[model samples]
Target: MRNDIQIDKRSIGINFIDGKASVRIWSPDSKSLEVKLENKSIPLTKDDFGFWTITTTNIQPGDLYKLVINNEQEFPDPASVSQPEGVHGRSAAVDVSSFNWTDQSWNNLPLADYILYELHTGTFTPEGTFEAMVSKLDYLKELGVNAIEIMPVAQFPGSRNWGYDGVFPFAVQDSYGGPEGLKKLVDACHAKGIAVVLDVVYNHMGPEGNYLGAFGPYFTSKYNTPWGNAINFDDAHCDGVRSYFIENVLMWFRDFHIDALRMDAVHAIKDFSPVHILREIKLHVNELSQHTGRQHHLIVELDLNDTRFINPLEEQGFGMDGQWIDEFHHALRVTATGESTGYYSDFSGIADLAKSYKDAYVFDGQYSHHRQKFFGIKAEKNPGQQFVVFSQNHDQVGNRMLGERTSELVSYEMQKLLAGAVLASPYLPMLFMGEEYSEPNRFMYFVSHTDKELAEAVRKGRKEEFAAFHAEGEAPDPVSEETFNNSKLQWNLVKEGQHKTMFNFYQQLIQLRKEQPALKHLNRQHLKVSFDEAAKTLLLHRWHEDQHVVCLMNFSQQEQKIQAPTEASNWRKLLASHEPQWLGKTEAPETFEAGEEILLQPESIVIYQNS
Candidate 1:
C-alpha cells in the first residue's frame, strides 16, 4: 500500500553503477528479449515482475543499441534518454551523471512568485534550438517572468512537432539539442534565478515510430483517447504500466533537475484503479524530494475543472500541486474580444470573468451550452496559487485554422486589458510566447511525420477542428515546412512601435504583481470581484493585511462608467492602461478616492492602491 511504502530513487532504462553498465527493461509480452549492441546481441534474464535485467561491462556509454524482441524485431528502449537519429533510429547510450551542474545553492521560488512564460522551442526563435533559447533568458528575466514553461521536449518523429506526438517518454528532443542541450539550458536558467517547467504528455504516445506496444502492453484497447489508444494504467498488468510512467516522472526531477512538470491533458488519462496513477506519481515525487532534498512540483493541464486533481492526497484526491484553468481564459477572451463563437458563446462576458476571479471555475456545476452538459464543480476550497490562469497558450492559439494569435484577433488596448485581468487575478499568471511584446506571428500546428498517411490524417483532423470553430479558408498544411516556418516568432518586432509599448506594459504589470502587497499574495478569500453586465465593466478588489488594491476594467468599445470600492479612501494610481505611455486614446487622472465615479477609457484597466 502507498501508505506504508517509502519509495526510493529507482533507475530505469540504461544506467551506470559501480563502474558497470546496467540495462533494464519491462517486457512481459515478449517471449525473448536481447540487448543488440554493435554487431552482437546478448540475452537478458527476465524476472517474475516481467522486467528484463542485465549488468555487464561490455555495454558502455556512446554505444548505439536496440532491444531485440522475440529474436526478430528491434526497437529503441522505451526509456531511452538519448535519441540521436530521431524516433525511428537507434537509442544512444547516455551517461546521465556526466553533466556538470553549477547551481548547487539553487532553490525554487514560492509558487505564488511564478510568472510563467510558455514557449515552444521550435517556434520561439529563428535558430530553434536549446542553445538559441539560452540567449533569450536574459530578455525573459527583464520581462519579469520568474519561470519558463517549455512545451514537450520528448523525442518525436522527424524534425518539427508540437511534441504531443512523442514516442520516447524519457528522451529529450534531439532536434532541440537532446539531453545535453537541455541540461545546459536548465543550468543557465538557474543561474539567472529562473525556474524551468517542462510540459510532458503522459496520456498517449504519438503514433509514428511508437514501438512500445511491440515489447509490452503499454496501451490498452478497452478505452480510446482523442489522439489514440489510452495508456494502460488501470487495466490488466497495470502495475508495470504505472511504473513505466511513474519512473518517467522521477527521471525528469532526479536526473534533469526540472523544477516542475506540466502534465498535458490529464482529462484524457483514463485510469480507474483503486489507487489512481496520478496520485501514485505524486507520492513518488514526495519520496524523490525526500531522497534528493529538493522541491519539485507537478502542475497538470486539464480541461476538467474538478478540484480533485488539486485536492490533498489525504482527502482521496490526486494531490497535484497546481492546475491550469481554461475557463478563466475563455471568460476574459470572450469579454475583451466579444468573440461569442464555440466555447466563447457559453461565457457571459464580465459576469463569468468575475466568477472566475472569485472561484477560478466559472462553469462550476452549471450547464455548459458548448459541452452541452453540466460542467465542473466548485473549486473554492483550493487556494489561488494552485490555479494558473493564462490569456494565450499554445493550444488556445495554435489549434485554430489560421492560427491567429491574440494580437491578431484583438485591439491593442484590449490586449493591455487582458494582460491586466490575468495578472490581477489571485492565481498564478502565464503568458504565451511573444505575447509580452505582442509579436505578430501565427502559432500554427505543424508536425513532420515520416508516415505519409499519418501526416495526411493530421491535416484532415486540423481541417475538421477548424470547421468546428467556424473558421474560413483552407487550413494550413500541418506537415508542410512553410507551416512550420511561418509559426516562428519575429524577434525584430520587439524593437518596433506598439510592440515595444506592450512589452513595457507587461513588465510593469509583472513587476507590480510581484511588489504589490495585496497582489503579491494569492489569497482568494480576501478578494472581492464584481462586474456590471450593462456597462461591460469589472471591478476586482484585493486586500492583504493592511494593504488594499482595486483594479477597474472597461471591456466595451465605448467609454464606460465605474465606481471604486466604498471602504478604501485616499486611493493612489499605481498603473493604468489609460496612461499616455501605454498608448491609450483618452487621458485619465492618476488617482481616484472611495465611491468615486470614474469614466474609464474604452478597453482599458486601471489599478489603484490605497496609500
Candidate 2:
C-alpha cells in the first residue's frame, strides 16, 4: 500500500479488494467513525491520516450507507455521487462503470457554430425526469439547437426545485431520476448529435441540509452573500475545499461524459487567490479533455462586464471560453419591448443597441445611473464569438413579476425584429425553451421542500420581492403542484397559426446563420453600425474582404422611412420580416435625399446582402 497518499478525513471505510466493496472515511475530530449498512454497524480501522477502512463482502453497488461520525451524528458520505432520495437521506453507492454508454464515437460539436438552448429540468416536461426528457430530443434537434444547457441537477433538499438551492455538489438530484438517469440522457443526446452543458452552482449551497462544514472548513463568515456565508475558497484549509469542487468538475466529464459545464453566477464565487479556482478548474478540465480525446468547455455566467473572463491569461485574462453578456440581451429587450425598469433603466433606444452590437458592452466605463458608479470595460476589440447573446433566458423570464416571456410583452413584429438582431449578430445565440414557438405559458419559480418552515418562507419571500412591481394577486406559492404544472411547455402552441409561423421564421433564421460566412465571423472591428436616432431605425454593416451584409431594423410602431446612405445602392434584400413584398429595391436612395422614405411596417426588421 502507498502510505504517501493523504487520506480524506471524512472517509468511513476504504478497502481495495479484488471483488468485495471497500469503504473509507476520515474523521480526525471524531473518536469513532462507523459505517452503517442494512441495520448493522461496522467499526472502521483508523489509519495514519485519520482514515478508517473496511473491506466488506456484503457491501455492493446499490447499497445504502451512512457514516456515524463521533458515534453521535450520522451523515451521508461527503464524496457521495448519488443521493437517491434527497440531500438529507442516505447516500446510494453507484458504480459509474456499470452503466453501459452507447456514444462511443460521439464527438463534441464545435463551439463556434453553437446555438445553445437553456432549459430547466424540473419543469421542462410533465414527468420532470431525465428519462421523460428523452422524448424531447427530437423537438430540440428540429428546432436547430446544437447544444442543450440544462439547469443545475445537483441534489437539494427537495423533490422539485429550480436547482439553485442545490446542496450536494457531486450527487445528481434523486427527484430528477438520479445518476443513472442523467447518464442515460447524456448518452442519448450524444447519439442524436446534441451536446450537453451542465449548469453548476458553486457559490454557495442551499440554506438547509448542507453538511460541508461538519467535515471541514468549506465556508467562511468573512463575507456575506444573499444566501449566507460565502464559500471558503481563499481561506485557511481552502486548498482541500477547492480540490473538492475541482474533482467534482472532473467527475462530471470523466464519468457522465458531459460535453461542457456552465458555471452559474461566477461573479459570486468571490475568489482572490493567486491562481483563481476558475483558472485551476480550466487547467484540470483541459488536461482531462486531452487525455480522453474529448473536447471539454467551460462557460461562465458572469454579471461583471469583465473581458478578463474570456481573454487569455497571457493577455492578463481569466481564460474562460465565453461569458453571458446581459448587456446585449438588455439592449435588445429595451428596443423590442420599450420597458425601462430595474436593470433595463440604463437601456433605452437604438444607441444602446448599436453600441452593444458593435462592441459587446453598453456600459463600457460609462456613467451608470443604476449602479451610481462607472461600470464595465471597453470590449470594442474582442471577438463577438467570445460572448453569448440572448433575447430571453431563465433569469430574465423567471425573475419577472409573473414570469412572462417577450411574446407576452411585445408585438409579434417586434419579436421577429428581436430574433433578427440575435440571429444575425456575430456572437453565439441562445434561446430559452419554447421561445421559438412563442409559447404563451410562463416558467415560474417552483420548489417542493421537505421542511415546511423553509417552504413557507420561500413562498412569502417570492410574494414580497415583487411588491415593487405592483403585480396583481399574491405570487403563486412555489411549493404548490399547480406552479409546476403551469410552467410546462404547451406543445399544442406549435400547431397554432401565428405560433407556427414564428417557429418557421426562427428555423429560417438559424439556417441563414449557418449558411452565411459573414454572420459566423467573430471579428468586431470589421463591422460598422449606423442609426438614424430620430427615425428609430438602424443599419448594421458587416464586411469581410469584398463581401458585406447589411441589417436594418425599424423600432417604431408606425411605418416610417429614411434616405439610404451611399453604401445602400449595392444592397439587395436577402431576408425581411415581411418578405416577398420588398424583393427588389436594390438601388440605394440618394445620400442627400432628405425626406426620401423607404416604407417600413410597424416594428419590422430587414436584412440586405451586397450583391
Note the Cα lDDT for every prediction shown.
0.89, 0.78
For each candidate, give its TM-score against the true structure.
Answer: 0.98, 0.91
Per-candidate total of colliding backbone pairs: 0, 12
Q: Write the per-residue lDDT of candidate 1 for residues 1-611, one digit (tens) a residue.
A: 33322244446688887778878889997889988999888899998878898998988898899999998898998889999988888999887777799978887777878999999999998999999999999999999998999999999998899999999999999989999999999999999999999999989989998998887888898898886688999888877888888888888887788999999999999998888889999988988888888899999998988889999999999999999988899888888877887778898878889999998999889888889999889987899989999999998998777889989999888899999999998999999999999988899999999888888888888878766678889988889999999999999999789899999999999999989989999999999988899889999999999999999899998888888788677788899897889887666677788888998888899998996
lDDT of 2 at 502: 86
Off by over 4 Å in 2: 1-28, 42-58, 467-473, 563-569, 579-597
Name the Cα RMSD for model 1.
Answer: 1.5
Model 1 bad stretches (over 4 Å): 1-10
Residue 547 local lDDT, model 1: 93
Per-candidate RMSD, Å: 1.5, 4.0
Scored by TM-score, the top model is 1
